[model samples]
Target chain A: MKFLTPAQVTALMQDAVDAQGVDLGQIRAQLVLSPSERVDWLIAAVENLRAFRQKL
Target chain B: MTFDPRVICRILAEEGTEFVVIGGFAAAVRGSTVLTFDIDVVPDRERSNLEKLARALRRLNAQLRTGSEVLPLSINADFLDQMQVSLTLTTDFGDLDLVFQPAGPKASYADWADGADHVDLGNRLIVAIAALDDIIASKRAANRVKDQAALPALEALSEQIKSQT
Candidate 1:
């Protein structure tokens, strides 16, 4: 495998950090949901997580 | 068991137990894209309300959640009154946290309810949701590693809400 230069490695790390940072787009998408829909979304998400954890 | 907050909130409302939803779940209600596995609520400290909450808890079959094992919970008005900080419990609907005083300036249930946003969750089930600002303040005051991690997203969501309104 070709080794990346130090500067390239640093840039890649920064890009990874940026990817993990807060996504305003996702937040805005959630905001489009009504209060009740938001709650529904939360419940569904939690349920899915629980199922995934159980399988693990 | 599934983490069904609607069933949990419905039980509380049906029992006429007054409370304000808080913590990560409240953040999500306020449009934060955070995934909370449990429901956190600050219940009214009145004796009658505590009694109502006790009834609701019993209906949910709530038991104290412990690291080693789940302990049986004896929920009563006096028992709830003596709980100075918080209690974590597991119910059929999933995990539930009863927060007597959240870590923030507005510590009491009434204080949170005063500025809470009333959300109608359909089915004639309207519940009080702690304001996004209060949620952010409490998370800041909490300052836990997890809380700190969640703050950036929560703050961004709060700013977004403010910009709109």
Candidate 2:
């Protein structure tokens, strides 16, 4: 119902990405992407994070 | 060559399909850190929207992912308007699960609409994604091993979001 602001959503996403072992360097590299492309990279990052966790 | 969930989301959004993105993909969008191969959505069961949903699925080349035989059933307006249960399909993009009943506190897309958040993925791809609380409730209600495992973190994330407000 209530929507989180874009800032809040970004902060939560960063926390989850860090907790799931996605590195800052990787995200930094993706920062250059357009907003749309950045969304794609983030989705891939989540998949990679899960794949990394599965190997452990 | 797996396609992102966004691919399907864009297709449905462009077709004006009335749906709320739910399940794991919703969790991921909300920053759950959970990975899901499929995109699950609860399409509005209204006769008009259901027809639109069928057309969108057809455009994606959806095939039955459930039964032993992978038939590409005609997801016509009749099927959508009449089907009582959820439908799961495999597509070029990936797995796409269309549910009328999502099995939690909010069992239907109609139940979830009030709480849904419209997400703009840039490039004119706008989707209505389920709220975090609803996703957590749905997962808890589903109670599968993976769903259970995801709870702790989702719960923590939910709390974190609450605290920020």
Candidate 3:
């Protein structure tokens, strides 16, 4: 994946804060998942998305 | 620009672009399914084709970088001279990698519309992914520890295919 520019990351982070009612920091925390971890990476990714969108 | 990876694969296939499925989608195509967000294609031939591809991307406003710096928003062509390029796309959605299969006598291609069991992607075109049998061979040839770990599941799928055959 390409690196997100600092500005773009900040803007996206802000949007998540305004649109979802969760914490972006927590969501970012969950984005990293091992490909073969036995646990469901998709489920973890979803929670990350929710945590990212905690504004509304 | 914004296209579904499967759809893109089908289109490329129709355009006579020969490729093999890799990544999570390849596993899914082999029936040990997993969620895949990007298209992973390895061309049947490398070298000349890869050079042509590098020139094409050079014209597309893509900046090729190396080292600790992350890949730019488009394909990187700087490493093409080495033979194959592992093309990665990073979009607003996520990231996908399409690694070109290294060329020469060692290369192989998949057959589409094998007419037995097939899933039509669009326009009646199907994803002629590597057969379960071949996936086993490749994962073994890859020989990475992680890839080896996937061998049993792949072998099981191959066994199932053999039984069906």
What lDDT would each prediction earn against the true structure? 0.89, 0.77, 0.47
* Model 3 lDDT at residue B132: 49
Q: Could you give the candidate ranking by TM-score, starting with the highest? A: 1, 2, 3
Candidate 1 structure quality by residue, lDDT tens digits, B1-165: 777888999999999999999999888888988788889999999999999999999999999998789999888888988999999999999899999989989999889999998888767678999998899899999999889888878888988888998
Comparing 2 with 3 on DockQ, the higher-scoring candidate is 2
Chain A (alone) TM-scores for all candidate structures: 0.62, 0.44, 0.33
Q: Which residue pairs in candidate 3 collide?
A: A20-A53, A20-A54, A20-A55, A21-A54, A21-A55, A22-A54
TM-score of each: 0.89, 0.76, 0.49
Model 3 B-chain TM: 0.59
Put down candidate 2 lDDT per residue, A3-48, tens digits, no spaces: 9999999999878755775433433343344445645755687578
Scored by lDDT, the top model is: 1
Q: Is candidate 1 or candidate 3 better by lDDT?
A: 1
Runs of candidate 3 exceeding 4 Å displacement? A1-56, B1-4, B10-16, B34-38, B46-69, B73-85, B91-94, B102-119
Chain B global fold similarity (TM-score) for predicted model 1 against the true chain B: 0.97
Taking chain A of model 3 alone, its TM-score versus the true chain A equals 0.33
User: Candidate 1, DockQ to 2 decimals?
Assistant: 0.60
Winning candidate number (TM-score):
1
Docking band of candidate 3: incorrect
